[model samples]
Target: MFKRIAATAAATVLAAAGLVACGSESGENAPGEGNDTVTIKIGTTDADQQAWTAFEQKAKDEGIKLNIEKFTEYPPVNPALDEGQIEVSKFQTINYQAQYNASAGKDLRIIGSGEINILGLYWKDHSSLDGIEGEEVAVPNDPSNQGRAINVLVQAGLVTLKDGAPKLTPTPADIDAAASKVSVVAVDASQTPSAYHEGRPAVINNNWLSRAGIDPASSVAADDPNSELAEPYINVFTVRAEDVDNPIYARLVEVWHSPEVTDALNKDSGGTAVQVKRDKEELNAILDKLTEEYK
Candidate 1:
């Protein structure tokens, strides 16, 4: 499913450049080339509220017009970015961005990282992992997120994966259910919260759970992002390879991580996301590694 979506995004990236660019015939919001003031179009999933408004105002004060293009999903953001409809986007983690680039053959690079969302096993009726026995639990079905969901279960002593199962992209088939306490039912990543509300214990993705209004502290178990296995999940600001060092873009990243927008980021993410200041070179190295591993 993810592969198909990625391919579609790639195809859009290939076909959307002239068609979607701002000055072209049919493009809606693409920036005008040679305009006196530069408008940097940014694709984002965050609600247009406190944090973003602060950043936009700061950018405006600095003489950069910030035009935000909102998206509800991740797949289309990259395509729009590749097509020049947006200059950069803040919607994906390092692994997801790497996977999209590898699958799409586009060199989208992470310019700065903002927050880390810890993925966890959340239950509606239950409060702890021990009581989860005999209850069928829901998990993400996508390769990367599924493996992450399963790993949390393993760490919580609920289930175990078979020997040699790829840790980075495991499926339910990799689970040794005979030795496990709970059975895992794989569903689309977006459906985990619904599955949980329907009386099933679910391993929900971080950002989605927060967006669904589920409190982060409600989770029974979660993976430690500080762990080496989970580092790839840190959410980042990404741009095309050509714009990695554009002074204006770099300034935006700088202002984003400063003390000015800290409260807004926390408030907007429901106080569940962690702010991390990672060097550009280090971020690129991790992306390169994940790209090679997942390719």
Candidate 2:
């Protein structure tokens, strides 16, 4: 599933790049120049969501045109933005971006903040974390989501971490199985729903809920978005380092926070998303700290 997502994202980016190349030959001034309407191409994983539909309409009303490219997974969005296939992307948390930046040696910059979707523990047969003792729980194996999933289990009092476990990026190895009530099974993020369907309670990311036919309100337990632990999980709108100060980009960020967009987003996520508002300086400081930690 991950490989397929990567391939599809790559193909979509290549096709978009071709269209951009052909469009460049018209010799028109770039967006945000003089009186030209600012047109920004945004890459996202949830372009089909009603939030984006509302965002597009609001942007149009504000005289800013948007071209949204949808991707199947989070991996390729940043690369698409870095390679100039898209101007900005809205998909990942600060921790995920920090890990990507550290590994890829790229300095993608976050220009705006987005909501944090509380990581949820969903069970098909169980209504609560209780009675799941000695059972196995599935979690996303990716560094960012896996760590958050482990934290969710910890918050639910079903798992205990060993001494000296990394606070931000804990793995199953960090879990003291002898002391914990449940054992964790890590699978690709895309397969978490499958794990849940197979009778194991799964720590599923919010983005997969719609695809897996899981109701967000049905989650047995979830991590608190307002806690200090969740600060790093706040989703963000990111762009190339050079575009960090672009006025049009700043305006676009404001548009994302508008009532229409937020209302639609809340509806789309089934109210699991907690809207976050943070300035760029604070966001950048958090990203810098996380990047250094990942390095």
Candidate 3:
């Protein structure tokens, strides 16, 4: 079942990359009304190219073509989608989307979720967390994710911060409870993989780790999926609020939840990116609150 879904996502993604027969509604795209090709432009960070490839292949058979635009950071992804420079983007957490909306005062909506999950703490020589004490721990320098990276250390019981640390701008001053002699270093997310060779234990993003061909399940000291951050932080698809009612958007959801896509993620994601079925009401309440939070 999962394999089938992964296959669909890769195929649908190809169509998303090319912009052909992309579905939308407007009498121009009335469902079951045949024979008009529409192009769908979707944006995403480069984390899920393989899964997107699976979805794109399936879209070709259905007469829709897609144009996929990739971004690296979290900031520019949604604004591009809303400008209709692209139709959708699948690069963020619900919490991230909410924050983006609130900061930008836009009404971006979550269309669906695919994969790309939490990162793992990795090292070349350390076999376990107990061995990591007093060593430098590497984390991303981005505001939201820097806090997230530190939280992983907390989860592993390697370091404890003063209460309310997450709400503040973290600096070396923020490490009120650094474990005796442990040190934390912040760098660009892109440099995390390379940090491993530098002999520091690294808290890495799931996507950056994957791009380096590292298997997260094997490298993790902790994962965000099973942490308190899971709900608001689940990765999701986003479109401008105006496009929520479109059937093509719904089809995008269908293609993601399809069995082919699921299997591929399970196999390819090192068992870290699990399929989570979010029923509509559940998603709505979460997204609604998140949207309000973003706004």
Instruction: Identify the candidate with maximal lDDT.
Output: 2
Can you tell me which runs of candidate 2 are displaced by over 4 Å?
A: 1-36
Clashing residue pairs, backbone N/CA/C < 3 A, model 2? none
User: On residues 1-295, what C-alpha lDDT tens digit does candidate 2 reach at each position?
Assistant: 1245643563455345432211133434343234444467888998888999999999878766787888998888888999988888998899989999999999999988988988899999777777899988999998888888999999889999999998777999999999999999999999999988998899998879999999999999999987767878999999999888655566677788889999999998899988898999889998998999899
At residue 287, give the lDDT of candidate 3. 64
**Which of 2 and 3 is ahead in lDDT?**
2
| Per-prediction TM-score to the true structure, in the order listed | 0.77, 0.83, 0.73
* Better by TM-score, candidate 3 or 1: 1
Task: Write the residue-wise lDDT of candidate 3 on 1-295 in tens digits.
Answer: 2356754774466445543334443424422344444557777775465667777766555555666777877678877887877787776777777777778787777766555466578987667776666788888887657766776676677766776654322454477654434678899999988998787789887768768767676674765564554566677767777767555555676667666667666666677786665644465567677566434
| Model 1 regions lying over 4 Å from their true place | 1-39, 47-49, 61-63, 206-213
List ranges where model 3 is wrong by over 4 Å: 1-32, 36-39, 59-76, 167-174, 178-181, 210-215, 266-271, 280-295
Q: How accurate is candidate 1 locally (lDDT)?
A: 0.76
In the order shown, what is each candidate's alpha-carbon RMSD?
A: 9.3, 9.2, 6.5
Candidate 2 similarity to native, TM-score: 0.83
lDDT of 1 by residue, 120-183 (tens): 8999856777677888889989866887888788878898888988766677999998989999
RMSD of 1: 9.3
